[model samples]
Target: MLKDKMKEVMQYNSILNQPNAQGRYKNYKCFHCKQMGHIAKFYPMDYKKEVSDMKKDTKVQGFKASKSTELITYPKIIHFSTTCMIKDTDLTNWDKIWYISDQINRHVCYKLDNFYNIKEGFSVTKLKNQKKFLFTYELGEVLIEESGKSIMILGMYYAPEVTLNILSLDLLEKQGFETKYDGNRCTLSLIFKDKEVHTFDEDRMKKMHNKYLQDYFESLSK
Candidate 1:
């Protein structure tokens, strides 16, 4: 039933592609911002390191900080990303990008590199904080408590047939999401007025979800 409804919605979205389409889409509001033509939490990017970053040794430009030796559990790479999508809005602007990028570098990836031996050259590249970076970890006994909150950061099992990256889970959880997993399958959905911080994921989402769980947990431990 839901798939059929989705099909109808897609058809309506296609109409916007017409030569002279305009105005708010009927029954086609974005789930993310509750606007038109998008969803509330749409994240489609490679959460792992990009190949271009590792392709060559470009001069160390951008933000620089002292390298440190620390014991940190880094976000496990399950897959890489190529592209992402966002609704057309003024809210999605350069300022947010720069801010997010800075956070990712200073708080998430760079710190993790200090503790764990992440991919080569990851330590040197300037990390950018995208919404996606915060959530990506392997599921283990590790739990990171941040903002005075206790939560587990988990990761995906590396398999022979699949690649993974981070996406919407972090944002969803921030909005109070409830997720569950059986070590292999992760099912995620919004929890309305709920208090439990336990998040869930399955299939491909599980790998990324676990990574997030790991990252969050490690951050708290530090």
Candidate 2:
């Protein structure tokens, strides 16, 4: 029974993977630049271009259109998700009918709720503080144990790319690990538990996992 239920849940993609349901939600616009097709980061100049440009441009491929995408000012390649609810009849029907009452009784379907993904990169077990890797496409969480401290993180919240790389470099430096980042690719060499560690890094994958680790470290620093 449990396996069957799990199989049923695995059928749908996470909200990030699903097509944006064309209801009332529109494309994202930059509040700073008043541009359409992108959020604030998409526009560089006004918000101290340094901070904006410092950001690595990670683009998500194959996203369907929304209201904000239709606007002329927004960048076409950038993606944005709506936060505030719009007062649309159709949207109202969805919220009132499906999300509220129906969802409680019947199987509810929403982008965020459909899938589970524990972290951005490939899940691993018994690495550093990580004890296990559990993932479902839509939502993901991580379990950490160190110095008798154990934590289970639940949700998509994670680190930015730059922060992750910086943190990873910092850790590697401490352990006398050698690493190189050629713009997009990052290589790390380390010695772990008397074993010579050698890794040919995937910049994209490293960034993905780094974001999570960086975010975790930042929270601790804070």
Candidate 3:
């Protein structure tokens, strides 16, 4: 029943080749935000939805749609993003491309080069296929950036298949950081103790990632 409804909705959304086809779903209204063309469940603002007890099964399970622009149901912990940009910071005109999830559980990262002291052997199942698994591991405390405020993650996981950089809201607050979500505003999401903190910078982290990779590959030749 729901699949049929979703099919009908997709037809309208595909007309303009846009996420939301304007004037297409005029009759559709979101009860949460009182917006048109989508419902509260499909609101891409947070890109979150309800799922089973993923936290109990694994710290970092498979998440979100394959494409950045494809919105779908996700776990409570994951603010599965179709867009690589953070939704909260988009309004401010920041060109940063890293994504921030309001994930209620553990945080997860995409690259091994970006992490240190993390144990491997952990695996994550894909959201679409529970049987398939991707190997990753626990991120105890990783310095995402080596300089310029030095953004760090408290508790996170590493998945090789993941593309976008992700942070766990659960461990972030437990690690002495606070977030402000004004219902829908969700502005200034990260803060250290009392002071406001900005999200991780992409360029700096990329530099650190490259450095790690260079050292790793160099050691292999030894």
Candidate 4:
């Protein structure tokens, strides 16, 4: 009688194992959490926690992510453009220019000829050890606009004509903005005083600057 009862129980379990309308068994196991009765997609996951953890890790590692193609969004971005000069001679003649952002720089720099009307009371100093093998002669303030917001940036006029105006990473951080870097891309975001701003894709901007530098160097070699 015990053997017969055991066989009946097995038969009932076999009947319960029949496929459902979705072609999955009634006792389907979730592929994600490995729990019974659901699939991977239906599994409940704490996506917010996962994302928060990821961002925390990113912050702990100096705000640099490993992925090259990752898209990082910021709350605010300041956009500006500057003209490039060859041989540092005609600074006023604006022909070709490119947009650029420097993640490692501390100050904005402009060619002397770019600013036509200059006030007499500005200080001029010889700045050395600049990146892209450039040097600066004069330092002054320039009023720049981004998203209708006007901010003054202390700009240095470099001896060599530069085709790009740089947004300084160090200065941005000092202004309460957070900087994040992923591969060639850099992002500056500010979240303070209940305000947010994000910049554009820095990877593309940096690449354009690098291309200009390469061409400049190549022309010099020629």
Candidate 5:
């Protein structure tokens, strides 16, 4: 039985700061300007803006444009399936990105594998410490596209130690959304579904996620 239901509903918790470098990954935060050391999808300024070119198209909605997100795993029993590569991007392959966070205050988005369909319990995350291993992940919903508009993340969290993919501006301000900021760009306007939203600037953060170190995004773009 799915390995006895994965040993009675999974449970993994043990991460007392394991980043290893760059000042322990600058304590990871950057859900954009909410800053700490940097990670706002690889923050870096002087980005002249230009991603509206998706020319060689590739295959986004079905994923393959690349940066990470091939989903569908099963690390424990469930017949031991495979294929999991988070470190995702849904702002469209401008360059791969999906990291916006208010420190994931209990999920409004969080993905690693399973893609989207998880449910019936599972979610336990942390990067600097906050040990929480309830069901250990399996709640879902993820369909962000931005620019072409589609935002529909209703509660994802299949976090397998999340490599990249976190969008929780304080749990999207508790579901009613309405966040605004201009300089470094950040916009999430109210009640979507028709109103739509997306304004991450820096030319959509230069097409998303670069993975720090361009002189640390040019010393925070000065």
Candidate 6:
């Protein structure tokens, strides 16, 4: 009886170790190329070709002059009065903390001073009047604690040229948050998550924008 029981256990272990009819131990799909049998981490990426293709596509689109005189609707801004602390260090001198709904920006951007020990080697080119400049920067992440709640800002670019940090509308939407603009005020709420967050009224929003504009013009003069 003991010999028969041992033989059955060995047979079960052998069957469990054997591959399925398709003959694959495990199936893996590449997230980037979307091909099977391999993962994204080990896949050889062609960065140069990707960047070249992107530039070519942009050039193909070209530029078209707008002929319409109709006024375009701009997104309302939300202002925060709380201080932005980076890793237990209070940024007392840095006061401008506001978010404007911008559909064009793909990533969240912050001033270089807001982060600590950023990892470098990334650059972006911005074109103005056919002139392009290399905007080099490092990437950093920060925890924004506001109104008794905290949100982690991932993949934030440390841009030195920008006067104020901007939270991208695309990023917010991608994170399952929705924004509703009612001309004078904007509300940001999460779709599936229930949490209390900070918001600004119309009057305070206007004040924040005015203060930023004043500081911007003053900086230009100097």
Q: How high is each candidate's TM-score?
A: 0.18, 0.15, 0.36, 0.29, 0.22, 0.38
Indicate the TM-score of model 2: 0.15
How much is the lDDT of residue 86 in candidate 2? 14
Compared with the true structure, model 4 gives a TM-score of 0.29
Any runs in candidate 5 off by more than 4 Å, and if so which? 1-101, 105-118, 121-123, 126-128, 131-137, 140-153, 156-167, 170-176, 180-214, 217-222
Q: What's the lDDT for residue 106 in model 6?
A: 40
Q: What range of 10 consecutive residues in model 6 has the weakest lDDT sum?
A: 80-89
Candidate 3 lowest-lDDT run of ten: 46-55
* Model 6 bad stretches (over 4 Å): 1-96, 108-110, 128-134, 180-189, 195-222
Q: What RMSD, rounded to one decimal, does every model reach?
A: 21.4, 26.6, 19.7, 21.8, 26.4, 19.8
Candidate 4 lDDT over 70-113, as tens digits, reads 44352222233322211222233443221234433545445443
**Candidate 5 lDDT by residue in tens digits, 11-115:** 111112224324755677755335454453444331112122342343233322236656645332111111221232344453234556554564433333325
C-alpha lDDT of all candidate models, in order: 0.35, 0.33, 0.51, 0.45, 0.47, 0.51
After superposition, the stretches of candidate 4 with alpha carbons farther than 4 Å from their true spots are 1-103, 113-133, 155-160, 177-222
Instruction: Give model 6's TM-score versus the native structure.
Output: 0.38
Runs off by more than 4 Å, candidate 2: 1-168, 181-184, 192-222
Write one digit per residue (lDDT tens) for candidate 2, span 1-222: 997576335422221233442222237654754534444443434344544564534322223323433433422221112112212213323422111111111111223221223333432122233332322123243332212333232342222111110112333345454544444333333445366566876997889999999999999998
**lDDT string, candidate 6, 124-190, tens digits:** 6554533544254656664454434555666666554444565577776887767666553444556
How close to the true structure is residue 197 of candidate 5, measured as C-alpha lDDT? 68
For model 3, residues 173-206, the per-residue Cα lDDT tens digits are: 6666665544433322245445656687999999
